[model samples]
Target: MDNLSNYFGQNINQKRIVVTGGTTGIGKAIAKLLVSLGGRVFVFGRDENDLNGALEVIKAKSFSGEILGISADITQKDDIDLIWNKVDNAFGGIDILVNNAALPARGIIEGNYEDWKYILETNVLGYIAFAKEAVNRMKVQKSGHIINIGSMSAEVKEKTGVIYVSTKTAIRGFSTALRKEINPLGIKVSHIEPGAVTSDMQEDSKEVQKEKIVSMEMLEAEDIAMSVLFCLSQPKRCDVVSMQIRPHLQII
Candidate 1:
């Protein structure tokens, strides 16, 4: 895709952006692209090493906007509070929030109750809590955008992927209802559902993922990042509410 900030003649310079799960995969790509487009971004992640890695890359990039990394687990309320406190001190206020933190899950047939709880806490509860924070702040500001990263499994509903699929489906509903409730308040909410992306979240081994990538059976992280930028670049009068992006060859 073309340079997003310049593509539609949009001016996002200095825009304060908060991205969850931004130390890897699709979130990292979004952070990199946002910085390249001159948007000040604060990316949150649970791992210190990954946060440092992402920060290094962001700093290495030559762009007008800068990036910061925060070490915090999205599932923790204390961490969430600290994230916002840091954001307030660093950016004064937020203009955009991207809820992208999620964990992959597999079959419930084995009764992996622990894994299921963790996934729900991270994917479902985490998103809702963080979004509630952004909505409260955005409501006061009277203008803001919250973008939720969902998955195509929300609709596809694969048998073995019940836990992961259920969370994405919940996100779809949350996005739609939140948009209706907040649109009149001047806040925009959107959901981006992607199909078969090559990421660490995949259940397959790295070797298999590599094969899929080589065969062009999956979408790159940057592809989803561009779609995010596309939604952000739209005119104020337009809201690209729900977008489902997939590689052309992806069967789903």
Candidate 2:
């Protein structure tokens, strides 16, 4: 068999990946799935305890590949630098970056400047900073992928949580422009927008969330994780620019 066809899907085996806010919820789920598929994964969160716990669980289930964890705030430049330094030493170079760290926003009228500032820094600027770092290395390799976890709230534009909505809208625009700017470098950018996922960010209780999931009124964090894997597994010629995933029964 001397076939020389170049058409093939991206294999996750041995791929170096960085996942932010990976101590819990969707980020953790994504990290777990990636590691299971044989991708070397580095995950970080703001809480030391959470990071440790997530690493424990992820490592236990990982049949192949490697996993590491660190506790650091994504909005801090020093923290990001520290993470990247460790990544360089551990993985040599990155093949993928998942920007997922974020804080839930209060109502527009509820918080003052400091509150809004914190959310903006974590949700908006943090993504940009991480992307910049990833691009620095990815451009040199001339191939990589950046997956941004967004929310459907950007388009839903509900009356409440205007701050969160605004940040998501900015992410939508940023992802579009980022793709255009970096696509020429052979790096792929994908924005995944999810709706009504049951996570720590939600106000609903565990029982309520479970019921909602049963009723298809909400999605599970793992659902979004699967979407991420789908995007990454595509062939290089096929770039999944953006994806919107919602529960079948969820409306809003």
Candidate 3:
């Protein structure tokens, strides 16, 4: 049976999943999809209040899957350890790792040193750190999947999105290499590149992000979230090397 839960999930019941930046926008959307499909999912957020609020809503659904939240800034190395600890105890082992946490992107021209550092810490290093952590457990289990949420900007340069584009480009390179390194060990790494998704990556107020959604014809967060599910649901013998989703009429 080709289980189809709207591409978000179907046969993924009880699969352990960890999604970073899952408090809102794309990450939250992914978490919700997983919950409805009966996957045990854990997510990280910097704000405890936001995290709790999202968790409450997810739990209220009371689906077969579990949805838990951890409050931490993924940019900090120490916090990654805390997250891992939760995962170790909460689910015992991780079957899927979604490196979805990222800092907002903006123009770069004599940018502030501190801002650049923050972006790099979260967008670049954090991704590698999580994979490293997951590998320790996944190798023992002999099977796992790492899905990196990248952007189409990695392939096409966009105006004023240089820094963000560069980081995603780095992810593209890193994911390809990481796959080669870990595939032999029974782990799968995939890069889900998206174009012009309606996400709050611009650091706007949540209210504003929501208001804009009513008018925009761009891809919804669910669009990207579904791709993630598709990758995870594939047959072990079939490796989806890469999947890119672009909203209609989006040039870049």
Tens-digit lDDT string for candidate 2 (1-252) = 223221112357799999999999999999998888788999999989999999999888746878997999987889989999999999999999999999889677898999899899999999999999999999998999999999999999877889999899899999999999999999999999999998999999999999999999999999999999988888789899999999999776
CA lDDT of every candidate: 0.87, 0.91, 0.86
TM-score of each: 0.94, 0.95, 0.91
Best by lDDT: 2
Colliding residue pairs in candidate 1: none
Q: Write the per-residue lDDT of candidate 1 for residues 1-252, one digit (tens) a residue.
A: 677536643535688899999999999999898888788899989889999999998888787788987899887789989998998899988888999999988667855777788789999998898888888888888999999999999999999888888899999999999899999999988899999887888877878877877788888899999899988888788999999998777886
Off by more than 4 A, model 1? 1-11, 205-207
Judged by lDDT relative to the true structure, which candidate is superior, 1 or 2? 2
Q: Which candidate order results from sorting by lDDT in descending order?
A: 2, 1, 3
Q: Rank the candidates by TM-score, best first.
A: 2, 1, 3
Query: Across residues 176-198, which tens digit of lDDT does each residue of candidate 3 receive?
Result: 99999999999999899987677
Spell out the clash pairs found in candidate 2. none
Tell me, what's the RMSD of every candidate? Answer: 2.2, 2.9, 2.3
Model 3, position 167, has a per-residue lDDT of 92
How does residue 165 of candidate 3 score in lDDT? 83
